[model samples]
Target: MSALRSRKIKYFFILPSIIWVLAFTIFPLFYSLGLSFFKVRLGKPTHFVGLANFERIINDYKLVNSLKVTLLYVAITVTVQIVLGILLALLFHQETKGKSILRALMILPIFCTPVAVGYLGLTIFYEEGGPLNSFLMSLFGAKIPWLSHPTWAWVAVLLLDIWQWTPFCFLVILAGLQSLSEEIYDAAYIDSSSEWEIFRKIALPMIQPVVIIVLLLRLIESFKIFDVIFSLTGGGPGTATEVFSLYTYRTGLRFFDFGYASALSYLLLAIVMIIINLFFKRIRAVYE
Candidate 1:
């Protein structure tokens, strides 16, 4: 009875969060799942369509294009973030003059919103009026169509994502570096290890967990990227930068193809789950 009473007391504190999750997250997820089976249209009767929606998605050219674009964006952004973040973290890990101020400046991008970052990208990359073009005009006297061409539009979006998120990876990696014991470094020095040998043999091994975590976070965040691309490219002069999220938004809200959009969302969820599982397996193997 005493144990039961203690359990009840703990349950009382947990009830609010459970209720909140049920009301907001669980409910919406189930509702969307339900909607995926019906042919729902505005001001029209929803008919059960079974797997018709899923079948349509299999043949959707635009959806395929969006998927390709989304994967490319995710791959490029995550790779750049991990590489730059680790380099920055390693650079700032040592004690030096003005290091504190440099660390603060390095983290500034993490505090900025995605929308603000996108707008800032516009200011820097805008074809005729931006600083990049202005500088180019001063030198070689030409402008780059950064946001107009389909290829360049994707590149521009990737740049915005990298600028805003590299700092996030840097912060996480830096924390991981701080958590490591200094004894290892001292021992390596006593053994007359070169700097490169110490980094490869000791530093990399110690920070592997942090690198995995940083890569996973960046992968998930990049896969669902919408705000920066939306604000900067609006999916571009064409469907060039139309990512999976924007594709879902257009289908659900703009086109009122609720069933199809829900199906697409679930498909994306499945893909992400698979990717995460594979990543975990790969990282676990490395640890072993």
Candidate 2:
């Protein structure tokens, strides 16, 4: 009786969380999935359209372009973040003056809200009198359009993502570095191994799990990037900066195309799942 009662009590404690997930997560997901199979627009009777929504998504030019832009953004941001993060981790791992203060300062950008960061990017990258162009103008008497041109707008968004999220990668890698066995490094030194050889052969391998984790997290988050691009560029000058999430938002909210938006979102979800699965499979194969 006591054991049964204890189990019931435990479930009672977890019931709220289960309800929350069902109400906010699972229910909405299933509802969206159902909605994707219909033709739903605001103030209109929804009618079952079978696979029409998905079919339309497959033929969507904006979706295709958004996919390309999203892939490019993810590729550039994740690659740069991982590389720079590891390098920063290694640099900060050394016993140096102001290391603590610098580490504290590094976390500030990560703590700031993404929307705020997007707005900050606007100020920093503004065309006429922004700080970046102002500096360039004074130095070289030239002012490049950071937001007006497609390429520079893309670059501006990329820089904002890198600045905001690199610290997350840095902190993860730094923790990995700190958790490493100093004894192994001491032995390597005793064997007359150079610092480069030690890091290349030992540290890198030891931190593989951390790197993978950081990569997965950054990839997922960057795939869903919207607010930064929305607030910064508003997918402006063209569809050049329209990421997948932003495109979906514009479709559903701005255009009131719920069914199509739902289909697009599911497509994105499937793509993310496939990529994640492939990444894990590759990692497993390599480790095996």
Candidate 3:
């Protein structure tokens, strides 16, 4: 085919993706931004009220609480995932029997859809006769509320998050570790470097980029976490586990306040952008 024709063919193939992004991504972004300036309610005319929705955010106690819990959740889950993930990656990196099988089992959770995992959590954490509760009963004869109460509800959410995402961190971090040459470790050993010393000095610095990437990915996902919480707890027994996304969803859909919901979602976007910016700045500073 001629160059022009070949290029035209490629464009033809790419056209659907371009349209999809425009329709779903770009349009909704600008649309939401515009919507945030309006006072939209069900069965009422939409009227622009400049900065009202954003201003209201300052006094919205529920919104503030949601952000707080969400941040706490992300902080705990991401930290645990990173710390435990690194340990598991290191364990799996060493030669051992049945480790391949253990790695396979660990990563299986990552392959499961968040919704499916949520439902699975529902079963496992059932307070009555559930596997976890039943095991607890057998051992201690007490039923712990897995989906009720603020503290336990938070625990449930964080636990499921840790269970699902830690494997992903392990897999990526392990890949980064495996890329290092054996000669590096042999040299370290020749230098009389202890195992912890090698990890703290050589392995960590080498994998810093990988760890940052994983942190960014997890932060983005955890901030927007909805599927698992929705399927598992539905924002819980009394909104105790409601995160930003869940609150925005309720405001827009359940309460039919699209203006405030749009504003809330935009705020979430801003928070995520800030986080990503800081990470990128750190990454650049490191290289510089």
Candidate 4:
């Protein structure tokens, strides 16, 4: 076949993907962008409102509260997941019996859907006559309310997210760890007497780029956290766990404020874009 024909064949193969993206992704994105600039309601005629919807964000106290909640969740979840994941990855990278079985079990949580995990968490964190409280009650003779209190509700959501996502970080970090050259470690061992020194000087540097990638992915995922919180806490205990995404959802579907909801969603998109760009710039600076 001619080069042009081969190129055409490649494009033909990718045509479906292009069409799918345009239909599902690009179309809805622009549609929502248009919707964000209008006043959309169930029974009312739609009209352009310019920046009216966006302007409400400044005075919206609930929006600020939701943002604070989301930032808190994101900060804690990402930090704990990264630290615990690194430790677990290091532990499993050792030459130990049952390592395969242990690693398999560790990654099992990541395979389960977030909704299912949330439901499972309900069982584990039951306030009255629940397993966790039961155990704590046995130890301290007091049951700490997991779902009923505001602070504990946030804690419950954080725990669920950390439980599910830490393994993902572990998997990625383990892969990066395993990709290192054995010779490099051997040379480092000869030069350094302490294991921490060797790991700090050689192993960590080798896997840092991978860790950065995992951090970026986790940050984005944490910022968009919805499903787990929806099934687990329903963003309740009086809005203690209501992240920004959940609030935006309530604004659109519950309150029937599509224009404002769309504006909130676009704000979230802009925040994510800004975060991603910062990370990208940092990565570029490192490489350049």
Tell me the whole-model lDDT of each prediction, alpha carbons only.
Answer: 0.87, 0.90, 0.90, 0.89
Tens digits of per-residue lDDT for model 3, 86-199: 998998899989987887888798978998888989999988899999999999989898887778877988899999999999999999999999999999999998999999
TM-scores for every candidate against the unseen true structure: 0.91, 0.92, 0.89, 0.92
lDDT for position 247 in model 4:
100
List residue ranges in candidate 2 displaced over 4 A.
Answer: 1-6, 43-45, 279-288
Ranking by lDDT: 2, 3, 4, 1
Taking the tens digit of each residue's C-alpha lDDT, what string does model 1 give over 14-51?
99999999999989989889889899888242799998
Name model 4 segments beyond 4 Å from true: 1-6, 43-45, 281-288
Ten contiguous residues minimizing lDDT sum, candidate 2:
1-10
RMSD of each: 3.5, 3.7, 3.9, 3.0
Considering summed lDDT, which 10 consecutive residues are worst modelled in model 1? 1-10
Clash count for candidate 4 is 0
Kindly list the per-residue Cα lDDT of model 2 for residues 250-281, writing each as its tens digit: 88988888889989989999999988996887
